[model samples]
Target: IMEYKRGSTLRRGQWTAFVFLLMIVHQCVGDIRYSITEEIKRGSVVGRFSQDLGIDVKTLSTRRPRIEFEGNTRYCDINQKTGDLIVNERMDREELCGQRPSCALLFDFFLENPLELHRVTLEIQDVNDNFPTFPNEVIKLEISESAIKGERFSIDEALDTDTGVNSVQGYTLSANEHFTLSVHTSADTGKYAEIVLEHELDREKQDELSLILTAYDGGKPQKSGTVVIQVRVLDANDNVPVFTQSIYKVSVPENATLGTAVVTVSASDADEGANGELTYEFSHISIKTKNTFSLDPKSGEIKIKTMIDFEDTSSFELRVKAKDGAGQAASCKVIVDVADINDNAPVILIKSLKSPLPENSPAGTEVALIYVQDRDSESNSKVRCSIEQNTYFKLSPSIKKHISLITAVELDRETQSEYNITLIATDEGYPPLSSFQTITLIVSDVNDNQPVFDEQSYSAYVTENNKPGSSLCYVTARDRDWRQNGTVVYSLLASDVDGDPLKNLFLLDSKTGVINLAGPIDYEEQPIYELRVLAKDGAGLVSYTKVLIDITDVNDNAPVILIKTLTNPIPENVAPRALWPWR
Candidate 1:
């Protein structure tokens, strides 16, 4: 027989047994049956029974019935619900009666089976074992130098393995006076938190610093872990320098020597060290001479490197530079004044006067003086004079410092009123330089003596029958002056010596000095006539002379005649005498 246990109601170490009895006089036994009250537990066995008396017995179920019987032929019956057994035949033990009775036998057995056949159940339990970790393992952040305080920056997420309420809950940061940290939810997933910065860092004060972050969970007893963060600060340039004034002015003597200090300049910077350091330089300019100037590279002091003379150069202007070590620089202008020094000599351009002088001019006349000028400073600008050549003229000898009248000369118009003269002018410089000028003089003439005629006595003749107003001869006078001054006029001064004015009457032409008969002349009363003549200039300066005239007769009248009557008286007488004779 086999036994089994079920659920919590079954007990351990429990079993049930079955028995079979045989009857000798059995014609055909009615069906026998027995009952066992237990279900088949997992890993248990089922019992078997048979109906053939001479065949073996076997257990079977109508639901699972593919089993056979073997061994003893005696047959028995079984109950499937209770697992009980019963027999129907009896027989001897050995050869049908050899040893013992077979009808009174009992048997027991054990079974082994699979646990799956029993329908077993199991349950699992939970525990907190893992910590939270960052997804990236290492994180980095960047920011500009211009970022101000309270500026914010983003943080990466942390991870954990525990589920639900036991996972990563919140985050915290190490205490930092300069900075603050916070946790924020991820917009993409509510499963992660982001670490954020709430404060700013300054590079000028602190270049770099470190921070710590911790992640916590919602377990009954909270669990957490920390991560390290590094922050770096950057730099910027912002400071500048300035100069106090834009330009500087100074004055120095023109005769200053090389390396002579003229002036100094000053500047300031608000920065320190290399950023604020400064330097200086100069510019090129044109001057009267080969001289130069320079500025100190470090001190910014101005100085002259060559000699200065007012005669060569009078003034100058200088351009200068000022710079810092940072390569940033500025420029300024400087004015330099050079004082005066005496150095130049005087020069004379031209001198001389040439013109005619009237005759008989006075002895103290001023003919001409010299002209000159000097180019120099102060007392050296003064000039003086003298006459190197003074034969034809004389110099006064007292004139000085006056270029126009260095020497005075007198002119004489008598013997030789004309002269060619020369004069010289000199300056007061160390090696006094001199110059010369030349002039010329001329004489003029005046009127004085009266003119005279060449003859004192003269003669001429005319016929007694000639007409009046007829030309005879001309007379002339001479003067040294040319033209009108040298010509003379003539006039009759007196009558003839015959006492009969008509006998010597004559007329004289004033322009030609000619004589002619005034009336008809008779030789019986005056045979000759004489007269006095005068010659003069138009101004009436006079000279006198005499002229003689003579006359001749001609036959022109007839004689008267008377007659006598003698013949007639003779005839008459003869006749009377003859008559007296005849009577």
Candidate 2:
């Protein structure tokens, strides 16, 4: 008698309950593990379950060795007479084991008669179904512009699930002029590759390049995956600079100020690094042109160096050059046109004069002094002068551009004390320039006027800390004489302050009539200072005024205590009556 337990439900054709019957005297057989290609038909042979398990064919045929999948599906069954385990259902390895290299199907088996317990494992072998693939759709690489030939860059390998002849076998890169593909076998038997430089990289010509890399397997009709290879080239010094234009044109005013911009030129370079930087300068220079124009090295700007004169030269030709850090250069021509502007004016400068003539002087006496000049170019600045028509005065040329207004007839000073004559100047130009100035003639008067000071005495006080050349006081004088005869000048007379010259201690502004401190003052040296100042008319008539300067004290000196005397040898001998030194 034997007791049995159900192994679970094992279906045959439809569905059947699996029961395990144990014969008290029966032995358990070793489990069988067999491999077979997937996608097999229902009648495919798995293995000889009877012989491999030590069971006889007669016993296996009668008892019937059964294999049921865990999900109640019968995948293999023994022949009822031959004891051969055969496939009972379609087996797809991809669905059964996916991409796993080691995959097996475990099922329960139950036999009758004496009853027995055993297990079987069916391993599904994989076939080529999936293609090789890359983890990324594109591979990015950066190459230096200075890269030399034969330089290699390692790239990631492609991945494939299938093993043996079905896995990645090789790698190939698309054809290019600068690079080639080098393939190597990785330690894991995977195909690895590197990009080798066939030629040096030049970013100036081409900064970026694109290519393709294909990973392929040895399957029939070969399956492969492609990844885009993108390469970016970095910069290096390789090219020279080039100007945008061969020539440039500019116009500027003839009287343009120094540093006036004439034109700006721009250039470009194809190479990077130091080769791309550009600088500008005058390529062709002439003495006359160089004196009048200059260029900025960094900005490529041409500027006026000296004042230009349209009448002297209306047009100029310049050649400019541009250079790069690599010392390569290019040049262009610059045509500069100087436009005329109204800048020059006729000038009248006094040369000689004899005004304030005697009342009863005869005619033909030179009375006015003058000279004329124009600052335009030689052709435009040829100036001439003439005195306006008048009854008592006439214009007469004396020397080069020099003229005098002379008396036309005898004159009487009492009847008319003065005469105003106009001297006119003219230049030669398109619109000719002219200017006029008035000259005054006065009748003579005797030396009957003298200058008198507005104040007989001036007093001022300055602090000890006052800076040198500080204004202390103002004392002006007046004269009744007319014109130059009435002009009065003030001066400081020789004087002594603490035995020092007064001029050393004070100074006066001759025309403004201002007295200023000439040196630092000290209240301790001299508290008060007084001196006589003189006023003189143009005719040598003089008068005098007194100036007084009081110096105030400031806390600029530190206090000091002095010791008159102290006994040296009598100290240690007798000290009964002690005495302190007087200070």
Q: Pick the candidate with the highest lDDT.
A: 2
Error of 1 at 273 (Å): 9.4
Query: Across residues 250-328, which tens digit of lDDT does each residue of candidate 1 receive?
Result: 8887768889998887676665776567776553222222146767888888888877765434556665555555433
lDDT of 2: 0.71
Error of 2 at 213 (Å): 1.7
Least accurate 10 contiguous residues by lDDT in model 2: 11-20
In candidate 2, position 480 carries an lDDT of: 70
lDDT of 2 at 582: 40
Tens digit of lDDT per residue, candidate 2, span 1-583? 1112233222212111111232122234445567887777898788776666667888777774555444546778767677777888877765564344566776655564443445566777766677877756876665668867886765556766665677788998888899898998844335777788998988889989999999998877688989998887864445556788887888897878888888898899897766677888664334467678888899888889898887556778776767676445666778898876545667776544567787667797767545565656554666666668778887665432245567888776546779888877777656777888988888785445688888889899989868888989989899876667678998888888658898888998887789998988899888898878888888899899988888889888899988677656455766777874543
Q: Model 1 clash tally?
A: 11
Q: Candidate 2 versus the native: TM-score? A: 0.32
How far out, in Å, is residue 478 in model 1? 15
Task: Give the Cα-based TM-score of candidate 1 against the true structure.
Answer: 0.28
RMSD (CA, Å), each prediction: 70.7, 50.4
